[model samples]
Target: MAASRTIEDIINSDTDNEGDFEGFSSESDISVCSDLSDNDSESESEVDQPRNDEWTKRFTPITVNDFTCESGTKLPDSFDVNSASPLDYFWLLFSMELFVEIARNTNRYAKWRMDQTGTVDPYWTETTPNEIRAFIGMEIIMGINQLPDTMMYWSKNPLIGNAGIQDIMTANRYQKVRQYFHVSDREKEPARGHRDYDRLYKVRPILDHVTVSFLLNYNVGRELAVDEAMIRYSGKLSFRQYMPAKPIKRGIKVWMACDSNSSYLSRFQVYLGRSAVGVEHGLGFNVVSGLTNNIHGTYRHVYFDNFFTSIPLLEHLYENGLYGCGTVRVNRRGFPTELKKPKEIKNRGESMVMQKGDSNLIATVWKDKRLVHHLSTLNQPDDIQPAQRRVGPTVLQLQQPASVKSYNKYMGGVDQHDQLRMNYTVGRNSKKWWRYLFWFLVNCSIVNAFIMYKETSKRPRNKKRYTHIDFRIELAQGLISGYTGRKRKASEIDCIPLVDSQNVSGHINGKLSGPKGRCRYHLKTLGVRRETVYGCTVCRVHLCRDGCHARFHNL
Candidate 1:
C-alpha cells in the first residue's frame, strides 16, 4: 500500500505541465524536435516543425532507438594501493612497466636522432632509467614553479633565491631531456602501414598505455560528461581547430569523457581531420557512444553541451540504460519548436515545460535575461527546484526547473578538467604536434593521481592535505630522491686532482693550512671555488693540465 500511495501521491501532485490530464496515457508523449513524425497518423503542423531545414540537414538525425549493447566482464576495482607511500601515487599511476617502455622508446629515438644529426655527447651515449627519472623530475619542478627565459639560466643562477635546479642537476642534463624526449619507438614498430594509419602514430604507444592505465585505475561515479578540450598549439597541422570561444583558439582538439564530480578523464579521442571516417552516426553521437562504451548499461547520467546534445543521442543513451541531460540548440533535430520561438519579456523568471507521450522525455524553457532550453531523459516535466539568485544587490530565492539545474550542475565537469590541466600544465611549446598530446596525457595522469590521493586519504580535518601545487612539488622531490639514484651532481665529476707540488703537500693531502683561499688548479677544473686554504695567485699555485684543463677547453 505504501508503494501504491507513493505512486498515487506523485500522480496527484502538481506538475509544470499546466494541468494534469486524468485520462491521458503516460506513453502518449512527444519529444521536442526539429523534425516531426509519428508511427501513427499524427502529422505535426508546419508551426511545430523548424522554420528551415538547412540547420537540421547538417546533422544526420537518428530516428530510431534500436541501440543494443553486449555485456562484458566487469573490471577489477581499484583500492588504496598508495596509502603507505606518497610516492606511490606516481608509481601507481605511471607503473614501472609503463615507465620502462617510455624510457626504451625515448632512448631508441634519441640515439636515432643523434645519429642522423651527427651530434654526439658522452653523457648522451646511452640514456639510463635514473636519468629518465631525473628528466621527469625536472619537468615536474618546472610545472610547480616559473621557468627562466633560457634553459641554461636554471643552472647558472640561483633562480629559486637560495638554490637552483643545478643544485640537483646540471642544466645540460635538463636540456638533453627536453631535446630528445620521444614517446614512440619509430624503428622497432614502424608507424607506416599500421591499422591506425599514421593518425596518432607519433605518440600512439604512450597514448594507448596511459589511457589504459587511467581507465583501469579509477572508478567513475554515477554522473559523467563528454566534452572537447583544446591543447594550445600553433602548428601547421591538418587537424588543428580554430575555436574562438576557447582560450587557446588555435590548437589541437580532443574529444574527452570524464567523471562529473572529480573531472577524471576516463577516455579520450584525438580528432584527426579527414582521417576520422569510421563513425556511422554523427560525431556527437559517436563520441558519446564510444566514450561510454565501457560503462554501457551502468545507468550513469552523461551530460554535455548543445554541440553534442540531440534527441537521437539522448534516445541512444536511454536505450542503453544511460541517462543524458544537456542544453539543446534550437536548430538541432528533435528540438521543440515552441521553445525556439521568440518571446517578449513578460517577467524576470517565467518558464515552460513540455513532455513526450508514453515516454519520460522532458524539455524545459526558462526565461531570465533570455530564453534557455534544456533536454533530458532523467527529469520530470513538473520537477521544480529553488536556487539562490542575485537581484540588484540582494540574493533572493528563485525557482528553477530540475533539468536546467541538473544540466548546469554536471555540464562543467570537462571545463573543470581543462582548468586544472592548464593551471600547472606540464606542456611546453614544441615543434612536434604530438608533444602537445604527450604532455596532455601527463597532465591528465597527474590530475587523476591527485584525485585518487584525495579519495583514499583518511587524514583528520586538521591534518594538512596535499594541494595540486603541493602534489607537483612532492612528486618532483620524490622522483629525484627515489628514482634518480645519483647521490651527487654531475658537477662533482669536474672536481680537481692534486698536482702533488713540493710546497703544497698539506693541500695535496686535502687539508687546509690557514685562512681559506681559491686554488688556481681547482679554479680551472671546478670553474669557481672559495672554501679551502690553498695558494693564491701571489704564491703561483700549479694548475693541472691533462685531466682538468684539457677536458675544460675541449668541453
Candidate 2:
C-alpha cells in the first residue's frame, strides 16, 4: 500500500520531482486517475508534497474588475461630453482625421492615437458631418483656440466634412478654397464685372499663401507658412488655347507685405501670368482695377516690385490716396529724366546725369489716329519741391555669395563673353532678358524681404542689431558656400572703394579676386558687382576722367 495524497500534494510532487517520474517503470502503479479515488490516498499525497510556507501564505487571490474607490465613484461610460465643446469635437475630428492620414502614410499617428484612446476609429467615420467636420477640418488646417465651451460648440455647428477636407487642411488649402469660393461666381458675372471680381478676389488667396509662405521670415515658430506660391493649369487643350477658353492654362503669382512685428500678411496681390511682368496682361490689369475699386480708403504706402511699379499704376494708386515704394524699371514711364538711359547705363559704371527737370519718360502706344503713353498724373507739378527722398536705396543690390551659391542652379552663370557681348545678347532679346531678370529679382527680393521680416520679428526684449550689410553678408555666404563649395574670403576686394566729390578714386586693388573675379559670379552675387561697378566713382564709365571728352555731368 502507498500513502494517501491530496491534489495539491500530487501537483507539488509532480512539479518538484518532474524528472524523477521520467523513469517510473510500473505503468499500472502510476495510474494518476486511479490513485486519486480515496480520501486516505489524497491525505497521504498532501503529507508528502513539498511546500514553501512563506510563499504560500503571501500568495493571495487578486480579483480585478472595473476599479472603484471607497466613495463608489467610477469612470463615466462615455467621453467627457460636458468638458468638450462643439469646437473641441470639431477640432478633435479634424485633428484625428489628419492624424489618421499621417498615420496611414507613416504610421506615426496611428500608434499615438491607439495608445491615447485604446480604440481605432477610421477618419471617414468621424468626419462625416458638415458642422462638426468643417470646424474640425479648419482646426486641423488652421488651429484651435481656448474659449468658453458653449461658444466653441456653437461656432462649430456650421462646419461641414467632405472628401476635400484632406486637401483643405493642407498649408496650400487657402488658395484652393478661395478658388472654389470664387470660380463659380466669376463664371456667372458679366465679363466686365467678372474681371473686377477676379481682381479683388485675388487679394485673399494671395494673403493666405503669402502669410504661410513667409512664416519662416516672421519666425512664426512653425514650417507651416507658405512663402512662394505658383498655380499652373493643365487640361486637354491645344497649345494655343485663348483666354476664357475651356482647358485654358493659367498661372498666378503672389507677393505679400506683412505687419513689421506681427508677421501677419497685411497686403498682397495676385499676378496672372508666367512672370510678374505678365501682370501687364489684360487679366492682370483687370485684377488691379478690381482691387482698386474694393479698397475702402487711402493707404500710406503701396509697396510692390518693379513689375507693377509703372507710372500709370503708381498714378492710379496715388489717385486712391496711396503712396508707393517699389522697384521700377529704369525705363519705366515717369522715371526722372535725370536718370541715365538704359543703353548708356548697361554694363557701365554708375554716374548721375542732369536732364531737363520737366522731361519725364512716359509709356507711349499708338492707336489708329492717336498716340498714347502711360504717364504719372501724381508727379508733383515741377514747381513743387520734390517730396521727401525715397527712403531705401534706389539701386538694386547684387546677390550675396551665399545667395548666389544657393540660387545658381536657377540663375545660370554669366556668359563668358565680355560685358559688351553680354549687353548685346540681353539687349537683342530684351523681352526674354527682362522676363528672366524680373523673376530672378523677385526671388532675391523675397529673400531680402524674409531677412528683413525675421529681423523685425524678434522679441522686443531680446532684439539684436540687424542691418542691410549683415543681410548681404549672410546671403552672400549662403550662396557662395552653397553653390560652389567655396566661401567669400576676407579681402580688400570685398570692400567698396571710396571716391571723392568727383566720384573718382585710384584703383586700390589691381583686380577683384574670389567670386568678384569671376564674371559669371558678378551677375549672380548680390551687392557686390552692382555696388562695386555701379557705385565706383573712379571707373572710366562712371565719373569723367581728367582728359576724357565725354560730356561732364552733375547731380
Candidate 3:
C-alpha cells in the first residue's frame, strides 16, 4: 500500500521504509533500471524461475557455445605520449576544470565556515590553482616520506625537516588550506528529510567530475571486474561500513569496476548502507547493473564474486548482449539442487558442467582444494583448460573450465587496484569524513596516471624507467616547478630545481660570468635572509652581483 522507494531513497533515509527498491540513476553515461521488483509476487524474473523438478528436465550435459567478445586497449589513437611530461599524464585525470571547481568550492566553504562561526582568521586567503597544485605536491611528498605529524614536513628539527616540501609553501600556509579544503557548496545542500538530501552531497561534485574524466580518458577492455573496496575511515558517520573479513575493517564501502588487464578503475560508487535492504535483488544486483550500465550491448564479459552473482543478474546481462561469469552460491533460488553438494566431485581437479536448458547460461562445479560453483553466460560448457597445482616441489595439472580460468585471471583487478592505491596513499587524519574520500580520489588519480604513464610512454625520459616512488617524486617536482615558473619570469633564470636535485656540486665558486645582481646565496649583514638580486648570467638568474657570489656557489 505504501509507495515504492528507489535505491537513492533507501540510502537517503536512515530507517528501513516499506517500499519496493527500484529505479536508479547516476550523472551521465550510466543507465537506470526501471521498476525492478523485490519479491516473486511482483518480480517477473523470479516468477518464471524454474523449480528443482523443472531443472531436472531442463538440465543437459556439457555443450559448447562458441561466443567471445573482442578485447583491446582503449585510448585516443592520435594522442602521443613521447614528449609528454609526468605532470601531463597526471593532468589527464586531474584537469584544469576540476582544479578550478575545487578551488571555487573551497573558497565558498571557507566563507561559510567563517560566517557560521562569526569569526575571521588573519592568515587565511582564497587559494589559487597554483597554490592548490603545490598543496597537492606537498601531500604527495608527505605520502612518500611519512612523518608522525603533518607539521613535521616543515619541522625545524634536523631529524624531520624536509626542504623539498618546505620550499613549496610554509607550514602555516599548508595547514590553512587543509583546514578549509572542500568540494561542494554547503549553502545549497538540501535540508534534512527533503527529497533531495543526499548524504554524499559534499563531495558529489568532485566524484562527478573525476568519474567523467576517468571514463572519457580510457577505453574499457573486454574483461571488466566489479567489487567492493574500503576507504579506511573509522570516524563516526552514518554510512561507514565495517567488514571483519576485509584488511580494512572499517571505512566507507565503495563499489568499483576495473579493467582486468591493467587494473584501471573504470567506475566507482559509494555504498550508502546505514540499514539493511528489505528487498530481493538487493544491493548486489543494483550495484552490478549500475556499474556495468556503461558497457552494455558491447558483449563485454563482467566477472564478480559470489556476493553479486545470481540467476536474475546473469539473465539480465545475457539479455543486454553482455556476458557475466562469477562464483555462485548453491542456495540462490534458481540454482540446481542436484549440484549443491554432489558427492561424485570429490577428486581434486575434477569439474562438472551443465547448461541451463538451451540458453547461453552455464553452471560449473569445479573441485579444487574445495568445491567451487560458477555461473557464466559467455563460456562454453565443455571448454576445459589445464591448471597447475603445486604440491611441495612437484607440480601437477588440474582440469578447469574456461569460465573458471577467466574468473581466476580477471577477478583480482579490484584487489590489485586496492593494493596499488594503498601504496603511497595520500591519506591523512581528517575531521571531515568526505576528506578521506578526497584523499582516496587523489590516490586513485596517482595510480591511474602511473598506469597511463607506464602504458603510453616508451620511456618518460633519459632512456630510463620510473618506479612508483619515482613517479610520485617527479610529479611533485613538476607541480612545484610549474608553480615557481608562474610566480617569477623577470629574468633569464626561468626556474631552478629543488635544492636536493640542484647542481650544488662543482657549480659553486665558479667565476661570475653573467650580468650583475645582488648575491642569492648569503645572509645579509643584519642577519636577515637576503632578497637582493642574485644575478648569474651563467645560471640565468637576474640577481645583482655581490662579491660573495663566489662563496655562495661553493656552499
Candidate 4:
C-alpha cells in the first residue's frame, strides 16, 4: 500500500454512516457546513439497549480489540512542504485572487453608496490586489504592535507611532479599504424568508474559500479533536451564543477540527442558529460527523467534551473506521445503569467500569475530587493510567483510565489555536458584523500557515525557529513588498524590513521627526542613557547626534 493516500480516496466511503449517499442540490456550502449526515430518521440510535433498572459493577478490564482504529497522522500522498515559503503556506487558506474579488466588490459597494446619497467629492478610488494586500499586511503589523487605539499607529506622537505601517499605506486609505470592503453583492443577497438565504451571506466568499482551503492544504494527525470556538462578539444576532461558563461569554460559535499534537485547524463551520443546527440527528453527532466527513474511515482518534459525546455517537464511530472518547454527561442516553451510580466508586481514585452487554463501548466512572464519567470505544473500561494532582499544596497520586489521560492530552487543539490567535489579534471595533469574521479568518490564515511552515520546514536543526511574532512580521513585510498605495518616505528609501524593536541593519540619519527617546549607543556604551530627538531614519531608533548616532549605526 502507498505510504499515504489522497485525502478524498483515503475514505473511499461508499455511503455516509447514516444512510446511502443522496446527493443534495444545495452546495455543502452555499454558505453552510459541508456535511452528509442529514437523515430524516426519527431516531439516531442503531439499537437502543433495553433500559436496565438493576445495575452490576464489573472489576475486570475489557480487553477488546474489535473497535481499534488506524493510529498516527494521515500523511498526504504528496505535498511540497520542503520547498514552500510562508506566503506559499498562507495561500493554502487565503490568496491574492480572493483579495482581488474583495477589491472589486468594495468598489461596487462604494459606487452604490455614492449613488444612494447625492455626494459631490467621493475620495474612494478603485483598490488593486496589491493595495488590498498592503492593507492586510498593515493589519498584521498592527496586530503585533498593538497600542491603545488604531490611530496610534499613524499618530505623530513619537512615543507610540509606527512609520512602517504609515509608509506602506496612509491610515485614511487603510480605513477606506476597511470601510468599503465587501465579500458578496448586496443586491444579489436573498431575502430573509427565501429558502436559499444564508445568514453568513455577507462573508460567504471568504467562509467558503477558506473552509475549503483548510481541508485541501494539510493532512491531519491520528488524534484529532472537535470543539467549539468563540469569536467575541457582543453584537446582537439571532444565532449568537451566551455560555456563561466559557471565557468568551458571548459570541458566534464555530465548530472546528484541529490536530491533537499540532493544533492545526483542518475544518471549521460557523453556527447559524437552530436553522443550521440539526434536530433529527443529535447536534453532537451531526457536528462530529460533519467535521470529520473527509476522514471517516481513516481510523483517527477523535476527542471531544461532554457537549458532543453520546453512546450512539461512539457506537456509530466504532462501526466506521474511527475511534472516539470523551467525558460524557451522566444524563446522556446510552450509559448502562452500572456506570451511572453516584456512589459506585466510594474512594478518590477508585473507578467503576461497565460494557454495554458485550458491545465494544465501555463507560467508566472514576471518583477524584468528584466523579468523572467517560465513554470510549478506544479504551477498555479498566485500562488505567497513574496520574498526579495537587490539592491544598500536596500532590496526590491517583489512577485514571488511559482514555481520560488521552482526552486531557488531545482535547486542547481548538483552545491552542485560540491562544495563538488571541495573542496578536487584528481588526478594530466595527459596526459591520462580518468584519469580525474576516479578521478571524485572517488570523487563522497566519496561524495555520505558521503551523504548516513549522511542519514542512526544511531548516537545519540548529537554526532558530520562527516565533509567532517573527512569522507575523516577516509575513507583513512580504505582503507589503509590492505596495505602491502611497509615496515612499525618505527614510524608507533604502530601509530594511520594518521590524518591531529588532532592527536588522540600517544607517544613521541626521534629522529629527518627533519626540525624543533613549539613545541606543548611550545605553550600551555609557552605562547610562538619555533621550534625544535625533535618530536613524531607516531603523527609526532614537540616538544623540553628537556621539551616540555614529557609534550606534556603526555597530
Candidate 5:
C-alpha cells in the first residue's frame, strides 16, 4: 500500500502516470461510505500506526436530526410589491428621526462654515426635511444624468443642464454639505486608543445606521453567500485593497452576505486593515463567522469561494447549526489523507468521494477538464445533477455533483449585487476617501429601495415598472417641488421698492425721495440709474416696493 498524497501534490505534480483504460485508469476512485474506519483495512500497517490518527482525532461532525429549507424547495422569483412606493422604502430605511438628525448636522455645519468664511449668510439655510429630501433626490438624479466635467458643467451644459438645480441648491451648498456631513458629533467619538476606533470613526453613524437598517428590513433566503466588493476609490487610505482581478482593482474592500435567490444584501463588514475590531481566526473565518452570526442556529446554508473556505471553518459552521459548501484548496490541513491519494481520472465525468468520521461531511473530487474539489456538509457524494459544459465551443451536458452545482448557482449573489449597483452607480471621483463610502451607502440604499419596490409593487408582471432613471427623476421632482421658499424666476428684477423706503421712515407723504438707482435685472452695467427710494438686500437694486419684491421671487 502507498501513502495517500494531498490534492495539492496531485495537482502540482508532473507525473506521467496514465490510466489503463484506453489511456486512463480509475485509481482515484474511492467509495464515500458512512464510515472511514472500514477503509483503513486497505492500509495493512494499521496495527503498527498510533492508536489515534489525524482523521479520527479531527472532524467530529455532529449528526443533525432534521434538515429543511426555510423558504421551501423553490425560491421566489420575485417579491410581492404591494402598495408601497419608493418614498415608503426610502423612509423605512432612512427614518424621520434620521432626517431630523441630518437637518441638525447640516445646520451646525452651516453655522461653522459661516463663521469660517466670514460670509454674511450661511451657504445653506437651516435645511428642512423637504430640502434634505430634495438634496438626496438631486444626488440620485445626478447619478442617472451624470456630466463629464465638474459639477459646474451641470449649470453650463444646455442640453442636459438644469439651471434650476443650481439655483435651488447651489454648488457651494453641495460642497459645504459634503465637507461637513456628520452622522456623529466629533466630541463624542470613542477614544483613538481603542482597537476599532479608526474604522468606527471613518464609518460615521449615518453609514452604520443605514447598513443596519438594510439588514433589519430584509429577510434572507435559506441559501446565503458571502463575498467581497471593491468600492472604487483612488485616495490614500489605511485599509485600501488592491486586487488585480477586480475591475476596480484599487479601493476599499467590503465583505458582504446576501440572499442567493433574490440577491438582496443581508449584512456587511468593511475590511479595515489588521487592526479591525473583533477579528478572529484568519480574515476568511472572521468574515464568514461575523456575517453569519445572526443566522446561527438556523438551517441556512452558506456558500463561498475557495478564498474563504477551510475544513475548520466548515466544521464550526456545522457546530453552529448552519451548513456550508465551497471549493477547498487541496493544501488546507485536516482534509482526509486517503481522499488525497494520487490516482488517474479515467474520463471527464468520472468522480471519487471520501467521507471522514461519522459525520455527513464529505469531499468529492470530480475530474473534468481539470480536477475540481468541493466540500459540503449538506450534499452527498452520490447526489449528482445535470449541468452544461463548454467543450471547444460546443456545449455538452455533463453530470455534476450537487455540491458543485449548488456552489456555482449561489456563489455569485454578491456579484449580482455588484452588477445591479454598478448599473446606475452614484459614485464619482473625489478627493475625500469618505466620499467613496458615502456614495457606496447611497448606491446600496437605492438598490435596496429598488428591490423593496419590486417586491411590494402590486402591478402586473407584464406591466411596465419604473426604471432606475424614472425612479430617480420622480424623487428629484418631488424634493424640488416640495421646497417652501419663494422660487426665483427669470422675470424678477433685483430692485428695492420705492414704497418700502418711504414706509420704513414713516415719511410717506405721497412723495419719493432717495438716491438714484436702476433695476439690476434690466441692465448688465451699473452705470445707468433711475429714481428709486427702496433697495433689495441681495440684489442691491432700487425699484417699486410690492411689484419688484413679488416679481423677483414669483416670476
Candidate 6:
C-alpha cells in the first residue's frame, strides 16, 4: 500500500493549481460544455468567471483512521497502582481534603458566577469541586515543602502537563481552595453567650482582607514589585466627595522608594484630594513601620524623594535606626546660606567674593526648639567643615550641566578649547540649565534609591505619589513611571548623537564597522569617562555618575 499522507502534507498539496487531468473529461461533459458555449458567449463568460456569491460545502466520508487501542496492548495490574510513591499519596490526600473544604464554603460570589454562566451545576459536579481540592492539596504540599508556585508542578506525575498544572494553580482555583479552608460559622462560634462568642470570634478586617487576597493570588509570602500601578475611581456619595470630583476618573499617585536596581524598597498610596483629610496619613510609613516592627534586623539606609524628606520625617527614620538620603527642596529652611539670585560665586578677575549676604539673598538659621531635632546623627558634630554640611545641596547643584562643566574643566582635559565652548554655552544658558537641573536632581535621587534597594534586600518597598502630569508625560514617551532625566554634564557634548555622522553612514557594507560618532558612547569630544555610561536608554546621552538611570529613563 502507498504511504499515508500526514495532515501537513495534505494541506501543502496544490492539486487545483496543477490542472492535471487535461484529457480526462467524459464525452457527455465535453458535449454539454460545447453546447453551452455555442448557445451564448455571455453564458460562457458567466460560467468561466469566479463566483462572487458565498457558498458552503459539507463533508460526509471519513478519510482518517480512528483507532483507540492496539490489539497487542494490555492493561496494568492492580499491583502497579499500589506501587505509587508517598508524594503521590500525599498530593491525593491534600487535594481531596481541600476539595471537601471548597465544597463546604464556596463563596456566594462563586455561586453568582455559576448562576450568571448558567453552568453552575455542571461546573460544580464536573470540574469546580475536583479543582478546588486539587489546588488546596497542592498549596499545602508547596507550603510544607517550602517551594514556590512556579516549582509546585515539578513533583506532579508525568501525566500532568505543564499547562494542566498551571490551570490547577490559577487564582480562581485558589479561591475555590479558600472556600474549602474556611471554618463553618457554627465551628467558629460556640454555643455560648453573645459577649463571650464575640470575644472569641473577633474579626480582623484588614488582616483578613490582605491574607485572603494574597493567598488567592498565590502571593502569600512573596515580595511584591515596587512599581505597583493604581487607577482612580470616584463616586458622588458624600463619603467619596474628597476624591477628584471633576475628572471623576483619575490615576492614583504612588510614592515609591527603590534601590539602584529598580527593586522595590518601600512605597505608599496617596489618594487624590485637595485636602489631606482622607489622604496623606503616611500610608507608606504605616506599611514600612508594620513590616519593620515585626522584623528583627535593622535597615542601613532608607531612601526617599523630596516630598517625604521632611526634617521631622528624617528624624523619625533616624530614631528608628535607619539612615536616609533624599533631595531637599530649595525653599526648605535651615540651610547655612541661600542665594536669592543666580550669580557666579567664583570668578578669576573678581575683586571681592560676591557672598549671598552681599547680594539680595539672605541666609538665616531658625532655632525652633520644636523643630531642631536631628534625624540620623547630631548634625555630624560641629567640627565638620561648613562645606561638608553643604555637600548635599552642592551635590544637588552639581547635578546640573554648568556645575558639571566647571568640575570637568577643573579636572583638566587636554582639549581645553572645546571644553571652554561647552562651558560658556552652559554658563550663558544658566536659566534653562536650572530648569533641567531641578528635574535632573529629582531623577538622580530616584535612580540612586533604586540602585540602593536592589543592592540591599530581597523584599523591596514601593512608593505612592502620582501626578497626572507625570503619568501623561510618561505615557507619551512610552516610559515607566518615576523615571528621572539624563545624568550627563554639559561639557560632555561628544556624547550627543552627531546627526551629520548618521547621514554619512548610508547602508551596511556587510562587514563590521567601527563605532561611529552617532553611537551613544561616542566619547571623543566629551572625553570618555566612567560617568558617561550612566545615561538612560531614551536620553542616550552621557550623564554624571550622580544621576540615576531609573529616574532618567522614566523622565
For each candidate in the order shown, give its overall lDDT on alpha carbons: 0.65, 0.29, 0.73, 0.73, 0.64, 0.28
Best by TM-score: 4
Please give the distance, in angstroms, between residue 170's alpha carbon in candidate 1 and its true position after superposition: 1.9
Better of 4 and 5 by lDDT: 4
Following a full C-alpha superposition, what root-mean-square deviation does model 6 have from the true structure? Answer: 42.9
Give Cα distance to truth, residue 496, candidate 5, Å.
15
- Pick by TM-score: 3 or 5, better one: 3
lDDT of 4 by residue, 118-225 (tens): 784366788877888888888888788888788888887667888777777777877788888787877678999999998898988787777766765667777888
- lDDT at 273, model 3: 85
RMSD, candidate 3, Å: 12.1
Query: Sorted on TM-score, highest at the top, how do the candidates line up?
Result: 4, 3, 1, 5, 6, 2
RMSD of 4: 12.8
**476-536 per-residue lDDT for model 1 (tens digits):** 7776774433456445533334444322313332222224555455676577654443332
TM-scores of all predicted structures: 0.74, 0.26, 0.75, 0.76, 0.71, 0.27
Candidate 3 local lDDT, 1-555, one digit each (tens): 111233344224422122332322212322333556555444554444443234433443332222243333335566567777778878777776666777788899899999999999888989987777777787888888988888877676667888666556666877788988877887899998999998888877767666776765676577899999998888899888889998899999999999888998978988888445375686788899988765555567799999999999988877665789999999988897777888878899998877775566788889988999999977877788999999899898899989899899989989999988888879678878999898888889888888888877765466465788888888888876646312323232333322232334434322232234444554443344554433443565433344454445554
| Residue runs of model 6 more than 4 Å from their true location after superposition | 1-299, 331-555
Please give the TM-score that candidate 5 achieves against the real structure: 0.71
What is candidate 2's CA lDDT for residue 110?
Answer: 34
Report per-prediction Cα RMSD to one decimal. 11.6, 40.3, 12.1, 12.8, 13.2, 42.9
Highest lDDT scorer: 4
Q: Give per-residue CA lDDT, model 2, range 1-555, as digits (tens).
A: 012233224223422121332211112222232577798978765554323121111122211112111110112245354442222322211223332332232233333445567876443222222322232233222212223331232232335322222222322332222222211122223454454454333123222333223322222111011122222223321221234432224333443343322233323444443444544533423444443332212232233334455656644544543333333455654455434242333321222222112221122111111211222222221211211223266643221111111122211111111111111111011122122222222233333343333433332322276443333333323322222111332232334443333332343312232222222223343233332222232332322123121223321
Off by over 4 Å in 4: 1-83, 276-278, 460-463, 488-555
TM-score pick, better of 3 and 4: 4
Error of 1 at 407 (Å): 1.0
Error of 4 at 263 (Å): 0.8
Off by over 4 Å in 2: 1-228, 232-263, 267-299, 330-555
Q: Please write out the lDDT profile of model 6 over residues 1-555, one tens digit for every residue.
A: 111233234323431233221321112211224455466865774555423121111111111112121111111243132333222222211223433433444443355556666865432322355443354334333322342344435333444324333434443434343432322232445454555553212122211222222112110011111222222223222112222443324333323322222232222222323444553434444433433331111323343333444444444544543434343344544322222222433321111111121111112111111111111211111111211114345432111112112222221211222222122111011222121222222222222222222232233224354332222222222211122212332224333432321221231111111122232233433445343333332334433333232233333
lDDT minimum window of 10 residues, candidate 2: 420-429
